[model samples]
Structure formats: structure tokens, C-alpha cells
Target: LAAGARGLLVAPSWSAPDHPARYEEWVTGLPVPTVLVERLGVPGGPLDEMDRVRSDHAHGVLLAVRHLFGLGHATPLLVARADSPTAQAVRAGYARALDVMGLRAPLPVLDSSSAERHPVLFEETARGLADAVRTGRATAALMHNDEDATWMVRRLAELDVRVPGDLALVTYDDEVAALADTPLTAVAPPKRAVGRRAAELLVERLTTPGAEAEPRVHLDLLPTLRVRASCGPPTSP
Candidate 1:
């Protein structure tokens, strides 16, 4: 209010799993129009009525699982962290996708937390994945984000596990997945679109005289999968 801003596009921090309720309370009381970007509010919660835009991570997980199945692989094992909203979404999405596809998890979801900060955790996670592949427990896997997946690949190579040949891998967040030696297949969220839509929504609310009378909008943009060398070619069936 002091700066004379007409509207606000708020993007809450995703560094932690849970967002502070006080922040939501503050945003709720703001006089100016506000729109959230890439931040999902719990249904029926305090910020439930707020306008927001986020990626449909559940659909992204489904795409990864379905692609692996198309390549003659069983349900892909999930390797993810629980540190952020996106990570949690991917974890839940994997389980839901398995239920939808009527497939059982061959192995428990592996935790790749702190792998970037801890080389030991990274090595351990990579070993677990290699063991799953070598023992015929899993033929495919979906790792969250690009950094951890790339680290896992490097460690797996050391353990004599070959990408695609031994374990067809798909990673979330296409950011650096392409730069990996094997060029990991990844899910690409529409980040720019989310920001653009949030801004547009805020602008509409600020400009439209009767915008408060209109129902709030919640947009879930679907993410696209980028196929690469990691998952190999789809099997001819």
C-alpha cells in the first residue's frame, strides 16, 4: 500500500514442505488484488478462495509411468525428496498414478533427500536403485528434479548399471536433465506460463471494476514430458 502498487503476484517459498499459515493470513487481509503462482493452497483451507496457478504434477507422473509401460517396463520406481511442494506432489502423484494404472509397486519409493548436500546419501540412493535393477526388482525408475537424477546416474555408472539398458530412467524438472551424459527423459512444468497467467489474473482483478463479484480462478497447467536417450525408444507392440 505504501508503494502505491495496484496488485500483487505472490509466489510462496517452496524450500520447505509446509508453508507458514501466518503468511497466508497476511495475504488474505491485503487490500490489493493478489494472485498466487506455483503455490497450491489446501482445499477448504484459509487461502482456498485465493486465485492461483500451478502445474498438474499428478498428470506429469502419470505421463512418466505410462511412457515406461509403453517401453515394456513395469511400474517405475519413484525416487524423490520430501523437502518441497513439488517434491511432495511428485511423490503423491506416483502413488496415485500406480493406483490408476492398476499396478503394484515392486519396491518402496526411495528417498533422495539431502543427496546434493551429502555425497554419502547420494551414493546410497544410487546403490539402492542399482540393486533394484540388478536383482530384477525394478526395470524402470522416475527420479525427481534433475540434479539428484544426474548424480544417481554417475554413481550407477560406477556400480556397473547402465542407463536405459539396465534401468530406463525418467526425471522430473527438465532443467538440467538434458545436460546429463545420457540426456535423461524429464517432465517439463510450464513455469513461464504459470507466472504469465498469475500476472494476467492479477491485472484483470485490478482493472475490472466488478472483479470481486466474479468467482476466483484456480488453474492447473499440465506439464509435458521430454523424451530423451535415457528411457530408450518405445517398444513396438
Candidate 2:
């Protein structure tokens, strides 16, 4: 350090498709005490030796799936993007949840990113998703993030697919989900807790001397599920 900063809170570019091979080495070799914030370092991997804090996205997926299942929906479809680390985590969690619940998705995981940014792709995905609901292929869906969920809902409405009526919906992020026409139920990740814990970890490492410092810690905060009108009343068997 030229900046004279004693410690660092690092959040790498996890949104990228892949990380460079030597990325871990670089972080480990840093001059100051470092703690990762919602970034790399999968458990049991090399990066697990580092201090980090992140949300338990898999647990979040479980919450969504259980909620849908409790509503009498056999298996809810997944609509997600592969654009971010969070999205990828949610996607993996969804698959794992299906396995744990002994349930299979009625349809394949739909690509929410396919509808992002491009109007044509958005319309196409909407129509496909609507067809799945209309034909009894999928009765409910777990969509990642608020924006894409909102977009899909608007397009689905145009095609005569209604939320909580023809299809139950649970979006991943709670950001603006409550503002949607149907006020979607959503999974709210512990973003604030992640940051706060990360900062505390960094400070802890900074204050503790070489021999006194605690072991490298990886903290995972569980997300909360917010129920709303979008999920509607339970379905009948």
C-alpha cells in the first residue's frame, strides 16, 4: 500500500462468466487483510480459506419451492437469468430444491434473460411461458429478480395469462415486486447483513494480531420469503 489502507473489503467481478485461473492466488497474495463480500470462494474450494460473507441462495430457493408446494402446486417452473452470480446461484438452488423435495419441474427452467433488453425475445418467452400455463404444463413459476418478473408478467397478461389465477408467481428479488400489478411474493436476500458482516469480519481480522486472529470465516445469511397477493389462495387437489 500506497493508499495506506490496512484492510480491504473485496467484491470481485463475479458477474463474469468465469474467473481467471490465478484469481484466487492474486487475492490471497494481497498486501492487507482482505474479506470477500458476496463474491467467489465456494465452500471447500481454495477460496474457502479466505474470509467471506454471502447469502444462502440455495436456502432461498428452498423457501420459494416449499411455499409453492404448500399452495398445492405440484412443481413450479423456474424462470431465471444466467447474467449474475446471484442468478446462477438461484438457478442451481432451484435444481437442488427439486431433487430434495422429490418433485420434478413440469417444464424446463425458462431463461428469463432471454426476455431481458430485447423486445422480441421478451415477447417470445412470454408466449412460451403463457402456453405452458394455459395447457396445464406449468401451474406456478419462480422467476429470478424483480425486473424480469415484472416484464414477463406484463407480456403474459397480453397473451391472456393472469397472475395468481392461471399461474402463481414468486420472484427472487423483493426490490419492486410489491409495486407490480399483482404484488408478487418474493425472496428477499440478506444483502444488508452480508455487507455488515463482511465489514465486521474485515475489522476483526485487522484488529487481531497474527497469532490471535480467528480462523478464516465464511458466513452465509439466509434469505426471507415475503408472501403477497401474487401467490393467491392455495390450489385444490
Candidate 3:
């Protein structure tokens, strides 16, 4: 309130805990225009009327997994933050994709809170994935974010596991981080466009106070899958 910010644009860090709640509270009690980028299930009280844009995690995950399955991956595990709605949606998409192909299984899930606390966990996850590949358990992995996928890929390489050759990897968010990696494959979210649209909606509400519009606005942006080199044809030759 003290700062001279005309409008507030809240883009919560996906890696942060309690980001959803923090975002919810941040938008509360503020008269200025506000925009938020959040997952599903974040409470949108009167603020629901506010202009917001969200990434369609479910669709993004499903598209990526479907592509991997089309390429011959059988069992795909979903990796995400523990107990996140985004994770749940991604998992649902994974299951739906598998079910569509009639190859769905009880896939493994790995959740590590905050990348900072799980430095070693990435390596462990890579080892576990390698074991799965060796034992013919899992053939591909779907990560919640590009960071997790990148870490898993590096770790797998350290373990002498060849990407796409032995195991396939996929992830959400094709930001710079994902593109910087070798053979990066990711589902890119329309972040800037989402922010711009959300901002425009908030500005409209601010300029037209008490307009006869609903109190909440829910916007869903489509995300696309970007295939890269980390994943490959199924190892059935």
C-alpha cells in the first residue's frame, strides 16, 4: 500500500510452499488492480471477479504424455511437488492419456518440496528412474517443471543413463531453463500472454468500479508440448 505501485501483478513462484495461500491473501483487501498466475483450487472469493489467467496443467500434461506414449513409452511416472493441485491435475492427465492408450499402470510419483531442499533427491530420483528402466518398470517420466526435468536428466547422465535411448523425459514450462538444457523437451506455458491478459482485465475492473460484471473472472490459457532430444523411441529393438 505504501509503495507507489499503480497496479499489482502477482506471479507466485511455483517452487515456493504456501504460494497459493500467499497469493490469495496478497490479493485480499487491496483496492488497486491485481492480477495472479496460480493453479486450480486457489480460493477466489470476491476476487473471482478480478481478471486472471491460468495455465491448463491438465491439458499440458496430457499432451506431453500422449506424445511420449505415441513415441513408444509404456509406463510414465509423474514428478511434482507433494500434494499440489497442479500435481494432481498433471497426474490426472497422465492417467487419462495412459487409459486412452489402454496401457495405463500404477505409475510412481515423486514429490520433493522446494528445489533448494532436494538437491540430492534429484540424483536419487534419477537413480530410481534408471532402476525402473533396467527392470522394465517405467519407460518415461513427466515432471512438474522444467527444473525438475533438467535435474533428472543431468543425474541420469551421471549414472550413465542415455536419454531417449534408455529412458524418455518430459516436463511442463518451456522457459529459458528448459531450452538451455541439452535435448530439452517441455510443455511451454503462455506466461507473458497470461500476464498481459490478466493485467488488462484488472485494469478494466479498476477503471470501471462497481460495473455490473461478475466478481470473478476465470481464464484458461492453452499450453503446448515442445518435443526435444531427451526422449526417444521405446527401447524394444
Candidate 4:
């Protein structure tokens, strides 16, 4: 606290197991103002409890899933990080869409990494996914981010499968989606806008220092889906 640091624009990582607790402990008693960019350590709290700006990940996922569904994919699989709040929200959106569309019988989630430490499990998972695509059991798959999407596309290629021909891929996070070999279709979160809004809120809070009564600021930035060649028009069943 001796230095000239005024406030913090915080964005917690998905890797943090105790992100919320860490946030509370780190900023609760601090003398300076703080704002969280995405993912809170606390749950069920109102948006107004803290100064925060985050993307509406679930809605974005919903939009993408619906787009796939419109293309004749009733059973779209989601491959995600599995443990992140963002992933959970995306899963919920996928499930809700399936329910609304009156489709069931497909396992909707694929959370990578297993505790069994058995290579067979991963192998089986890969085989099953490849079979699903080849057999038209799953017409499309949604990856948590660009990296996973790229990895899956390459892996499928090794299986003698071609993306958009055998399977369609949509990914979250446009970060490196375009750089992929297939240039995946992906949800592009407003990263710059979220940061800009957080910075603005931090400045306001720092200047006021709770001098004037004000409502807490929370922003849920909407994301857009970037269509690319990875997604193909579905064939009629």
C-alpha cells in the first residue's frame, strides 16, 4: 500500500480453484478501489454487489447452438474445459436449447481430462466421438475455445476424417480460431470492451471513493458468433 497503486481491474483465471475466496480476501479490506472483469469468487450475489464487467457467455453459446440446430444438427456435442464457470454456463445454454427444441437422447457435454489416468478412456472417448461424426449421430460439436477446436480438428483428420464434411465445429473464444487450420466458427467475446468498461468503472470509483451514493456497476457484454468455413450445411437425414 506504500506505492502509488490506486485501484485494480481484476480478471480471475479459470485455473484458480478458489477464485471467489481469493477475490474476497484480496480486495475486501484493501484501501483502494477494485473491479472484477469476469468470473466472481462469490455466487448468487446480485450484479450490483461489485463493480464488474463480463461477457454473457451462456447467451452466446445458445445462439451458436441454435444456429447449428437450424442446420439439421439435433444432437450437438459440447467439448469444453469442464471446470470453468463460463463452461458451465455454456453447457446450461446448450441443454436449454435442446429442451426447447424437444430433442433428447444425446450426451451433451464432453469435459476433457480424466482421473483414471488410463489412456483407454481418452482413446475410447475419441473413438466414440469419431464414430458419432462418421455415423451422423452428431452433426456438429462445440469446443470451449479455439485451441481445443483446433486440436480436435487435427485429431479427427488423423482419424481420416474431414471437418465440415464429416463433422461441423463451432468454438468459443475467437482468440485463435481464425488461425486454426480450419479457421473455426467461434463466439467472439468483447474482450476489449469489457476491459475498457472495467477501467472506466475503476476510475469513477477511485475518484468518488464512495463520496456520493451510487449504484454498483455491472456490465454483461454480449458476444457475437463469427461464421467460418468450419461449419457446413447439414445434409438431410
Best by lDDT: 1
The Cα error of candidate 1 at residue 235, in Å, is 11
**Model 4, stretches more than 4 Å misplaced?**
14-25, 46-48, 99-105, 113-125, 208-212
- lDDT of candidate 1? 0.86
Residue pairs clashing, model 1: none
lDDT of 3 by residue, 188-228 (tens): 87778787787787777667767426566779988888877
Candidate 2 global CA lDDT score: 0.84
Q: Is candidate 2 or candidate 3 better by lDDT?
A: 2
Number of the top-ranking candidate, with TM-score as the measure: 1
- Candidate structures ordered by TM-score, highest first: 1, 2, 4, 3
User: Each candidate's TM vs. the true structure?
Assistant: 0.92, 0.92, 0.78, 0.84
lDDT score of residue 205 within candidate 2: 77
What lDDT is reached at residue 149 by model 2?
Answer: 91
lDDT against the true structure, each candidate = 0.86, 0.84, 0.69, 0.74
Residue-wise C-alpha lDDT for candidate 1, range 94-174, written one tens digit per residue:
999999999999889888855658778777788889998888888899999799889888788889988877888999989
Task: State the lDDT at 81 in candidate 3.
Answer: 60
lDDT of 4 by residue, 41-98 (tens): 4565332366778888877887788788878776688777666767666766677866
Better of 2 and 3 by TM-score: 2
